[model samples]
Target: MEKPFSDYWKEYLNIQNAPCGQVGDTNEDTLNLLKNSDVVCSVRFEYRNCRTRIPVLMKMEDGYKAIYPHLSAYPKESEAQLMKINIQIAQSAGVHITSNEIIYLNKEYIRKDYLDLNEFLLRSDHLFNRRNKPSKTIDECMEQYDFDLDEWIDTVQTLLDSPEFTLDRSKKCTTGRRCSYYDDCFDESKLPDDSILFLTTSSHKLQAYANGIRRISDLEPEDIEGFKLQYAQYMASKHGIFYDKVALKIWTSMIQYPISYLDFEWDTFAIPPYENMKAFDVLCFQYSLHIEDVNHNLSHHDFFDTADCREKFILSLLETIPKKGSILVYNMEGAEKLRLKQLGEQFPKYKEQLDQICDRMIDLSKPFECGLFYDNRMRGHYSLKKVLPVFTDEYSYHQLSIQNGLNAVFTYRTFDSALPEQKQVIRQELSNYCKMDTFAEYVIFHGLEKYLKEDDVNA
Candidate 1:
């Protein structure tokens, strides 16, 4: 595992082929261990094929190492060139292996019983035996890692660079849901406002980052659109080229057919609340649907402050929403669609109607997700909170009673348990927050249309 190849596998492929012992317990112990040998060989299985042991040869007490095949009959120097070289190197110096006896004639490799770091920790009860307690924060961990996050980032970037590897833009990053680094690396704000990720790329966002374009400003929408007009046009346009201001204008101006802006807030309790439900039952409690008749005048209908009436409330929501109108929601791809699908599954009798409702659902988040719209003030974030701020000076979550969905849901859950005075205050807060979501959508829709129509707006 000499310099290049040792780093090659470890950094690029995360494949470690090294001895299974801790190095340098004490300088004296390490010196004693290496004194009898000038050379050492270690073998460890590669993760992809656990059955195969990769042999690594190292100069004892030195970092220099190599990986040569293991076998019987030390080849004569007159024959087999690579083997002869290895044998000469081995014979001249004292060779050390797992077994004290290193037979010069026959080298053997044994299949290993393997355990990963996590599995080893769990088996030793180091992970699970700990009591629930406050843990070190990011700053603390950073201090332990030499307080050089830039170095770690450089290491990761260097490892990520590759001409052969690319992203599959058509598919979602499957590991995102489970990875601990998901938020740290792939959070919405980390991407560029005009990144190929927001538009269309053949590889994932990280790959794009490694390719020297960490932000949305790095993309060319015209080039992307030229390649694939339908889905990837937004990616190709460097100056927002493919964004059809006229098409967006047409959609926004069609405020007829009794328009509605819809939003829902739900909670998943660790313990089941309803019958036949296991732990982590997602209960949809609050729904705010703001409707406008043909005149574009707005009135809102809401369902909230219910704990025991989930089924009854859902039925009420179904009745409140009109069948034909466009149903607007933020991030419907993840939030609205998942909720509706779950609702349909829970109520088989109304599955067809629920599916139909989903069919008419219009995602208000399209512009942000597509990178057709961006605001410098947002700092490359498209969350509802960030997007809503750019729309109107009159609107804000800061002055509201409930500023976020999580807090709103928590308040709704406890509203009934509060005294009469607290109940009124909380109910008003919940109402105000939910109303703001719909109102923000209304403002954001108009803002996007305005942006699209503006001649000077950047891509």
Candidate 2:
């Protein structure tokens, strides 16, 4: 007969309390016991009057103290209202809940030998405890994030009762995440070619719309409020695409051969996988380098590892990249440069070489970033992927399996557990995606050069 979950947990806790006989044996035993235990892992809260249901409620208890888990690291913008609704439901059920707690995975513990539930639990401290502030309890959080319960109920009832509703286009939408229905709400395709939306630096979008300023051409110098770059972008869009030949020429002149166009793909794990690695430390798994020689010859070098390959990646880079020349990386300030700096700190033995690499590195995004280049087709985006399509149809990322950095990270992460055939496929997809980034840089460089020369000839 199988043991009841409560009994199993109680027995397991007893074993944990007992003196450790062996180092590895206790943890392994605990893990095996946990796997065998069967319990109600999920809870569904159904309201009688309300149509909505709370799908998952994580309940944590130690002795007589019980609390609901606050899962997120930071309180979300909508958390106050959501908490009020939850508290209202609890109150109606004759359950008095005073405060909420948080339970998160311990980032310090690596599952090297076996899973340690106690270690995990200890690490998953409540928000206040984690922040080292015992005085800031859940009650304080409730007070700080208080919402009007009656007003919330009224709003919910209004929403439920509404049969037909018009979209609130004028409502100031703000979020860190992209809205799915953005295209459905505001059709960018239907917008005029010279729409005020093209003004990338304009914070007065709503004001412009209100004042009947729709097109970039319609914008007066006075309307822009002394923003030279915004004015330049506006004038450029109105005439055609903007091209600063002298600025671009000077920018391109800095490119010394053998030019190494580099791109890296890395993943940030919540838990540290290796020694000296902190929680959410990035593991660089892959890199792609496209080298162009002084003789106009092109060669490619790349590295991909299924495991923690930080050391191997750096070594490969040092070997593959020539001792001399400029290293061009798109958005160097944001991605590549930061990654290199982190790597240098992680591997101090290679600090000198890494510092040299950083010294030679140049941002390929400068021209577009400085507003020296602009195309109407770019749609206010300066991303390499967006800029690439405007120049030539020769290169594209649409055909690749791993088209974006996020997809590459996800794919690489799954490689260790994947089947042999699947692993091979992931490897190829990652290589292709990273290679495209550097290759795109190469293409854009030449495209800009050709444009400059052609403009000079026409002049």
Candidate 3:
């Protein structure tokens, strides 16, 4: 007496079109009440033997297709094993699933309008379909990977049976992410000043550790496969901080009278929120500029917007920055210059001016990155956060409400639905955080100059 699965899907589509709820809200309870609902979403299953639980499982109408949604930027390497285990669990529950599908979010979905679930599914470009089709079958994938479900289960059992498990710190395992306990496990603070881990761009970490070359001072040039930066860092660590005075002076001398230290904070939405913005297009919502004039007077300018403020941000930036000045930015190669180029392309009217800004832009991280300056406290990183603390305790980001770029992005994204008071607090926090970034650059520039002067005095 039940209606077909297609009928339920048609009803679900109709419900989705209704404007009763907010854009992102899905009436889960209403969907559950529908008859002939074969598309089981978020079905939680627990395996008693392993004491493990799978939080989400999508069972299609055919009853043989199982789908798992992976949300991370990079897929987990253990995806196949995880899917196989899920299959086993489903089979035990009398669901005979023959094929598995990974419904991954496409990086290209620009959310210009309210997310339409049906449209999202129907759009070929919205999701990466890893379904068993004519091109690649589940059986073929299993065969290629030589997947044995029993062997995988035994491996899991062995892990579970272990009395006390500790992560292996013998070698750096590339999981594309740092573990939560990374600091506790590695304890870089406890490491020697001349630890081999400080060797710049060295890939022989495991080899060095294995061969008892734990310290940079203990290493010969050959130990790190003759990497110039590694040897330079090793030498610098052995001595005090490396200060290439002549090189530093040459680099800093090129700066025009007024120096503008610039920093930008932006967010990239997987779905484009606005018309002009494409999927994955960066929305630069905020910027900070610290200007030090020819008269040695310092001034600050900044902007923050919750809405589409790209044009305003760019125009404000142009106005704030002086016509003739060296624009210093930390890691210009990675962030500032690239952003300027992207902006120039996006807004052609200001392309010439943006190009001019790009020309004047100087990467402040170059001195540290190129080994012209190296400090033991830098801990193998030339990031503004890492480098700033090394120079002076006076300017520290630890006290700020929003410390990192990622946090800023997340905070800005929540501004839409936040309470008025909360929104004000977020705006203030974002401004403070961004101001600190530009201010830190100014401080670092002065620090470098001071270091150069001191080296001259000592000489």
Top candidate by TM-score: 3
Error of 1 at 300 (Å): 1.0
- How close is each model in CA RMSD to the real structure? 17.6, 8.1, 6.7
**What shift in Å separates residue 13 of candidate 2 from its native position after superposition?**
12
Per-residue lDDT over 188-234 for candidate 3, one digit per residue giving the tens place of the 0 to 100 score: 78887668866666677757776888878787656666754565577
lDDT tens per residue, model 1, 1-459: 014323332332233543332332332333344454443233321211111222344453433244333122232222223322333333323333221111111112111242122211111101111232224322232233323334544666666685554333323444335455445545666545555555333444456555776545455443333323323233333443345565566666654467688888888743334543323446777788888776778888998746656667668878998877788889987786777786676667877888888888888887666555555545444688988877787889998978999898778878777999998898888888988898888888767766765754664
Ordering by lDDT: 3, 2, 1
Query: Between the candidate structures 1 and 2, which one is better when assessed by TM-score?
Result: 2
What global local distance difference test value does model 3 have?
Answer: 0.69
- List clashing residue pairs in candidate 2: none
> What TM-score would candidate 1 get against the native?
0.50
Q: Write the per-residue lDDT of candidate 2 for residues 36-87, one digit (tens) a residue.
A: 4322122222244442222122223421112233322333334334555666
TM-score of each: 0.50, 0.78, 0.79
Clashes of 2: 0
